[model samples]
Target: MSLPVVTPGETDTYEDPLDLINEIDELKKEKDASIMAHFYVDGDIQDVADYTGDSLKLARDCTQVTTGTIVFAGVHFMGESAKIMNPAKRVLIPDMLAGCSLADSCPADQLQVFQEQLRAEGRKFDTVAYINTTAAVKSLCDWIVTSGNAAEIIDRVPKDREILFVPDQHLGRYLMEVSGRKMILWPGSCMVHEVFSIQGLVRAKRNNPGSVVIAHPECPQNILEITDFIGGTEKMRQHVMSVKEPTTFLVATESAMIHAFQKSAPQHNFIPVPGIIASTGETCACNRCPHMARNTLQKVRDCLKNESPEIEWRDYFQQARAVLDKSLLK
Candidate 1:
C-alpha cells in the first residue's frame, strides 16, 4: 500500500496551528502513541512530541517508550531506527517519503558490493556506518555511530583493523582528523550540509561580530575550518547553553535547529548560515533539510489517527538492532 505524500505548504492549510496541536494530543491518547521529534523538525511538532532529540538520543529514547505506537516526526531513517529498537511496537513516520540524503546516497546493495570488492582486495576493515542509513544498510554494518558518539566508537575500534565509513564523507573526514585514524570514506554527503556556502558563512561571521560559529561535522571542510565550535545537534545546544553572556550564533547546520537553540537559551541570538547554489553562487535559506520539512502537523495527526503507514518489521531488523544496541545504547 502506498502512503500519502505531503505536498509543499500543506501545513499552511491549518487555520489554527493550536487546533492541530490539540488534535494531535487527542490522537496520541486515543492511539496509545508516542511522538519522537528531531531537533531539525519544525518547532510545532517538537512542542507536541513526547520525546525530542538528535538521532542518538531519539534511538535511546524510543527504547524506553511505553506506548504501543511511535509516531516519528523526523525523516524515514529515524522511523526505521525506532522500529529496529522496539520491534514489538508499531513505528510510523509522518511522511514515509521523508528520507535522509545521506541514507539515500548509499543503498544497501551498493554498500554490499563495495564491501565485497574491498574484501577481495584483501583489505581488512570493519564497516562503521553513520546512523543516517536504511535498516538494510544497518544490518550489514559492523558498527553504527551517531554524531554524538562517533568519536568514542571510532576510538574503540581495534588498532589492527581498517575502518570503512559509509555515507557522509565530510563526517568521515572530520572523524579522521579528530580520531587520528584514517578511514576509507564513501563519497556521500548531506545535501543541506553540502550546500552551505563558505562565502555566506564568512559574510555572516563578519556581519555579526563576536558571534560564535557552531557547526555540525556533516558540513564541508571549508565551513568547518572557520567555525568556532563543532558538534552534533544536542552537543551544539549544550555548548551554547554553557555560555554565560548573551551572544549571537551563526549556525552551520539545519536552519530549523535554531528553534531549539532559542528555546534553550532565549537570551542568545541564533542565525542560520545561508547556503548557495554552487553553480549560480546565489545565496538561499537552503540549510533546512527538505526531508525534514516533509513532516507536518497534519501528517502527524493523520498517521497516528489512521495508523496505516506503520514501519513493518523486517527479518534484517534483528541484525540492525544488535549493532544499534552496541553503538547507541552502550
Candidate 2:
C-alpha cells in the first residue's frame, strides 16, 4: 500500500529542527496527541516522544495511554499495533511508507495458504508470529513472540505440539537452538540485520580489544555465535546500564541504536558494525534502517498538525488484537 507523502506544514514552516520541535510540542498539546517512538528511529524523534520503547513495550504503552490520538514515530506495523490495541483512539504514523522488511517478507495471504497446506497434510499447526508482522498475519497465528520473550514463550508450549515460527528466520533459528524445539521456520529476514559482515566484525573487535559484542537476535548465526550477549533493544539498554567496568560495545544492529545508547549512557563507547558493502549504493558507510529513517522531525510536525494520515481501523485488526490479548492475559 502506498502511504501519503507528507511535507512540512505550510503555515508553520520552521527554519531548524528546534523550531519544528517546538511546534510539535505545541501541536501535541492542542490536538491531545501522544507520541510513541521506537528505539530504532532517529534520536530526535525519540526525544520528542511521550514514550519510547521496543516493539512489545511500545504496544503495551499504546494500550495504557489515555490520549485522544497517537502519533507513532515508527514503522507501519507499529502504528497498526497501536490502533489494534486502542481501537477508539486515532493512530497516525509520521511516515506512512515507513515499513519493516521483516513484516513485508511475509504476506498474510501466503501465510494463510501455507497453514492450509500444513493442515491438509494432517499436521497440528501452532504458529508464533514475530511482532513485526502485519495485523492480518497476527490474526492467523496462535501466539506472538518478541525477541526479548521468544524463548520463554516457546519453552511454555507443550512439547507434543508442532510449532511454526514466522517472518524472522534468524530469530526462529535462535529460539530453536535455545529451546531444543524443532519447528518449521519462515524464510524471512530483516534487510538491516542481514548486512553484518563477519570479517569486518572480527576486525572491529580486534581493533578495540576488551570490547563486548551485543547483537540482536535478528542477526545471522555467524554474528550471534561470536556475540557476548544477544537480546532485544530493551535488554541491550539494560546490559549497557549495568556494566561496572568501562566498556566499549560492538553493536550489531541499526546505527540509530548507537545514538540512543550514547544519549542514555554517555560514558560508554559504542561502535556499530558496518554492512558488508558499506556504500548502501547511495550513502556513506552507515548501518541504518532506511524504513525507520523515513520519519523525520518535519514529518512529525506535519502529521500532528494535520493528522492527515490516520490509520484506518479494520475488522481484521480486532481479530489480531484478540489473539494478542488472549496470549498476554494467559
Candidate 3:
C-alpha cells in the first residue's frame, strides 16, 4: 500500500482572518444566532463558530446557549442531535445531506425490528445510543452517548440492567472490555475508523522519524496496539496541548482533525496515519467520510439567513429526549 501524505500542518489566511471573524460577530449581533462547528470543518467555520467541539460538547453547548437560531456546521447526525437537545430552538445546518456513514448503516426500520426481537425474547434493554447515530435512532434510545462520555454515562444505569449499544461494533466491544457490561451492539462502524491497521502503522513509525502514534478507541484492536495515546477528540487535543516537548505525532482517527491539532499546538508535529491492509488485497488507507465535507461558509450563511432548513424527528425520538435531559443534569 502507498503511504499517505501526513503533515505538521499550518494555516494560510485568505484576505484577512479578522474580516471573517468580524462578519460572524456582526451577524451574531443582528440575528441573535449561534454557529456551532465540528473540529473536522474548515478553519474559517471553526474560527467563526461560537463553539467548536465533538458530538458531546456540541450537543451540550447548544442546549446551554440562549440563541434563537443554531447554525450547525457539521454532518446530519450532529444537527439532529443538536435539535433533539434544543427542540424549542431553531436548528439549521450548512448542508442538509451531511449524513454520517455510521448512522446510515443503522436505518430506523432495521433497528426497530432488532428492538422488537429483543422484546420477543422477553428481554428489555436500557438502550444507550451512540451520538454517531441518526436522530431517528436516538429517538428509540433511552440515553445518548458520545465517545467523550459513553463509559461515564453507561455507569449511570443500574449495573444489573442490560444494554443495547448501537452503530459501532468496535466501539461497543471496546466498551464491553472497559465497562465489563454485555450489550447488544449493532453491527456498524464509521468507514474512517474502520480503516486503521496495526501493521501499516508500524511501518509508518519505522519510516517517519520521531513520530509518536495517537488513536481514537473506535479503531479495531490490531491498530490500537501501536498507538501511544487513545481517547476522544478533546482528549487527543489535550494530549498535544499538555506536551512540552516539540514532538511529532501520527493521528489514527479522521485526518481532518489534524487541522485543529496543529492549530492548538503549532510547534508540535502531527502526521495522519493510513489505515491497515487486509488479506483480500485491499489496503485500509486514505479514506475520508464524504458527509463531513458537506459544510461550507456559503451554505452556513444561507441556512441562518433563510432559516428554511428545519429538522424534525419522529414522536418516539422527541419522547426519548427525557434520557438526554437526565444526562444534562449529570
Candidate 4:
C-alpha cells in the first residue's frame, strides 16, 4: 500500500518552519511516524522531532521505539544506523543526499582490505563504530559507540589487544592520549569539526581573554590540547547549560550548536570557531556537512508520505548482530 503524501508549501505563502513542523503531527499519525534529530541540526527541526538527542542517546533509542516509520533529521550516517537496527521498519531521511564527511573519508573497500591485513597478522579487533559513520561502516563494525560512551565502551577491550579506530583521527588520538593505549587509527576526519584552524583558535583565545576554549574530541590535538573541556555535542551543550558566570566561550564545533547554547544560557556568550578552510576565497565552500543539511521540513514530509529515500542494510542482520552480541556480551 502507498503512503499518503503531504505537499509542503514551497511557495511564498508558507514562511514559517513552525507551520511545516505543526503539519507533520497531523499528517503522519502520531503513533506511526517518529522523528529523531541530532543536536547539530537546525533548532526548529530539533524542536519538531519526536525525540531529540545526541548520537549515543539516539543509538540506544533504536532499541526503545517501535515506530512503523522513522524519519531521521540527522545526517545519512545516523539514519542508516537506525535502518540497520530496524530493517523490518521503514527508515527515511528527509534528504537522501545529506551525507557525513567523516564517514566518506574512509571508503568501505579500503577499510575491508585493512581488516583483512589485520587478520593475516593474527590480530583480531572488536569494531566499535562512532554513530557518525555510515551504515556500511556500522555494518562492518562489531559494536556502535557515541562520544558519550566511547571511552567507557572501548576501555572494556583487553589492554594488549590491537584495534582499528575509524574516521575521526582527532577523537582517536584523544582516546589514545587519555587512555595510554595503542590502536591503529584510520586517518578520516569530520569536515565541519576539523576546519577549526590552530592559528585561528589561538587568535580567538588571545582576543577573548577570559573566555575558555571547549571543543569536541574530534578536533585536532593542537585544538583539544589547549581546550578547557573536551567532549561530544551533548556534553558541550550541557557545559553551557550547567556553567554559570562565564563571560564567554569559544566553541570549536558546528555553528548550529550556538543557537541552543545561547537559548539556554542567555547570560553567557559564545563564538563559533571560524572554519578558515570552508571560506578560503574559494568559488564555493560551505563546511556544513552537505549530508547533515539535506533535511528540511519539506523533505521530512515527503519521506513520511512516500518513504521515497529508504535505507537498506546490506549484510545479513545476524552478521552485524553477532559482532554486536559478542562485544556487548558481558
Candidate with best lDDT:
1
TM-score of model number 1 = 0.96
Better of 1 and 3 by TM-score: 1
In model 3, the runs with Cα more than 4 Å from the true position are 1-25, 276-287
Note the Cα lDDT for every prediction shown. Answer: 0.90, 0.87, 0.78, 0.73
Instruction: Name every residue pair that clashes in candidate 1.
Output: none
What is the total number of backbone clashes in candidate 3? 3
Clashes of each: 0, 0, 3, 2
What TM-score would each prediction reach against the true structure? 0.96, 0.93, 0.86, 0.86
Off-target runs (Cα >4 Å) in candidate 2 are: 1-14, 278-285
Task: Give the per-residue Cα lDDT of candidate 2 at 129.
Answer: 93
Q: Which candidate, 1 or 2, would have the higher lDDT against the true structure?
A: 1
Q: Write the per-residue lDDT of candidate 3 for residues 1-330, one digit (tens) a residue.
A: 112212246232233446645766777778789999898777678878889988777878987989898888888878777887888888888777777888888998899899999989988688888878776777777887877888898898788779999888888888888898988888998877887766678877998888888888888877776678888888899899999899989888887788789889998888788764445745555545557665656556657667758776557656657766776547
Error of 3 at 14 (Å): 13
True-structure RMSD, every candidate: 3.0, 3.6, 5.6, 5.0
After superposition, candidate 1 runs with Cα above 4 Å error: 1-12
